[model samples]
Target: MKIEHPAPMQWQFSRRAEQLQSSVIREILKVTMRPEITSFAGGLPSPATFPVERMREAFDAVLSRQGSVALQYGPSDGYAPLREWVADHLSTDGVRILPEQVLMTSGSQQALDLLAKVLIDQGSKVLVETPSYLGALQAFSVYEPEFVSVPTDDGGLLPETVAPIAQGARLLYALPNFQNPTGRTLSVERRLALVETCARLGLPLIEDDPYGALSYRGEPLPKMLGMNPHGVIYMGSFSKVLTPGIRLGYVVAPVPLVRKLEQAKQAADLHTSQLTQMVVHEVVKDGFLTQHIPTIRALYADRCQVMLSAMDEFFPKSATWTRPEGGMFIWVTLPKHIDSMKLLEEAIAQHVAFVPGTSFYANVPETNTLRLSFVTVPPERIRDGVEKLGRLIAAKA
Candidate 1:
């Protein structure tokens, strides 16, 4: 067989695509899919919560009733009924949004991608919650924005730190409730302060709330969108409550931004899946989410207590971890001498693994930190995993 010679024509590509790298966690998951690895590394939810049998019903119904539309290409705007459903549900947050404002994304992660496409240009300034969602970081990175982190305390983001920085920033990506990594909810005081500060500065805010409904403790604080709807782009997902495999998520951006986001969506693969939208719509219409979410909360609450108790029993005094009220993750800060990336190698060697904190930061990672998730494993594995992690720390000490 003879190979065809290349057409030696000069070609160029978007500077952004040339700089991008595939997700690290996605690659790691392929290895962890093996039965032997007790992976604490993944952000996966518990399989017990995935309504596989119900999904089979959804698939059958969609095919039997709405086969062509379900399988064929959809409008760039997304399925209308599902958009209306999301808009109606969002009304509970005191947000007055129409179905037109909602863009169905493959997941909230893709919503981040669309926003980055619309908002970020080279050297554009982006600010994030310190140790914010790593997927958000990866999505925003393709545009090569200059990222700056704001310090957060137990109650979440410190507004005094953020007020001055909002000065000429293009975007503020906030995971205010039950934030990933830390699992801390922004206090009502900080939320209000953040809202006021950002709105005053005319900065575009991206409010990512994939973990809001999963809270097991504390009173719900008013959403940032409620405080100032005009300036915030709110991102939400069914990945936690319903199922992630469906890839259903949406973003409610403020008016002007919403228009551009739709154009960006057109370029980024047309739209989110129509069949998945119909399935989610069917389940949501049946009131399963309202009933299903509380069970998830209960299971996670019980698991959180078990993990916290295990942390108290096993973790060394030199190490400290966040006690998150609601959310899937807990961040741990190890002793200064411990580089989490180095320690992850040790952890994986013991048949246990976790994401190193280095990957989460936009600038330099606080090498002593790492995130541990409590929702994926059964409580017994969390206990055993924490014990193993503890033993490794002791050995290193």
Candidate 2:
């Protein structure tokens, strides 16, 4: 028996598994979780804005009324009523979305995965804005596509520059309203031009709008999905407005693509949680978000202003940052010599943390940049964190 021992077997993973890397922001968040840390690293919505009472009531009602159905497995596409609700909610005067076109997922992040799975082949040319959402990049990279970073300015992705590089591209992804890392909203003029350009080139566009509803003013800009319903795939999430814990997000695309995504989703998870879909539908079906979203906007607006003011007062004159009208993030650019990855190490020693901009880029990363999220932190803590970061930058500069 002693001579019959076998050696340990080594597991072989696929090539795609090797390409996957841990999210830098997520890793930083683990360090920031310490109570002493004043973290602006996560794009987490303020817990104060969560509809605790309403969510409680909704969950109770669902359990009391339709407990069996809520607990049972749901359609792969999603709960029927919730799909209808999303379709109706997103429908505009010019663009009418049918219930058939909606596919609810665990979150928009899952939608990104499904889209990549369906649309991307090996070496597929996928287009993304320079410094696009890190989550999107992480999702897309799993499929091993060739990511082409399109140029962007303050207003967001450049439309004119798109077509030239757009040749042979599988799809163009953009966050037209309040982008994640930069918080730069695409202008209406550029939005129109971008849609038209994509249409002319027969390129598909992925419109990810998690923070669109968080606009400081009550008004959100027109969605690209409204411009070219058939050509664009729109992804929206309740994570920013409602609580992220339940994990509900959706996609509105052409019926054909919706079917394909549904098939992919079925293969992945079969469906998003039946209870979560029903509970959220019960909450949002009767115009709850109409009143609720405004509260979030106001709180985030105040916090954003506080952070901006602190940056002005504390940050060095050599530093520059985005002035976001809405959303949780502000992208900061320090002097070119300063690497934000190293700066984050110094910041953690001072009990503060942020996501370095290098993770946000698909191709050439700008190491001098970093993203700050203001919503979760208190105003005083926001100021303290910004001041500490400022002092650090001043020393480096």
Q: Whole-model lDDT, candidate 2? A: 0.93
lDDT (C-alpha) at residue 332 in model 2? 95
- Cα RMSD to native, each candidate? 2.3, 1.5
TM-score of each: 0.94, 0.98
For candidate 1, lDDT tens digit of each residue in 1-397?
8769967887687777688887767776777787766777787888888878777888888889998988889977789998898888777645577888888899888899899998998789999988788889888898888998988777777888987776668899989988877888888888888888888888877889998888785345678887887888899999988888888889997667777888898988888888888888877877777778888888888888898999999989889888888878888889889888888878877777787777777786798988887787877888888899999987766
Please identify model 2 stretches exceeding 4 Å from their true place: 1-6
**Tens digit of per-residue lDDT, candidate 2, span 151-244:** 9998889999998898899999999888989999999999999999999999999999999998998889999999999899999999999999
> What's the lDDT for residue 388 in model 2?
95
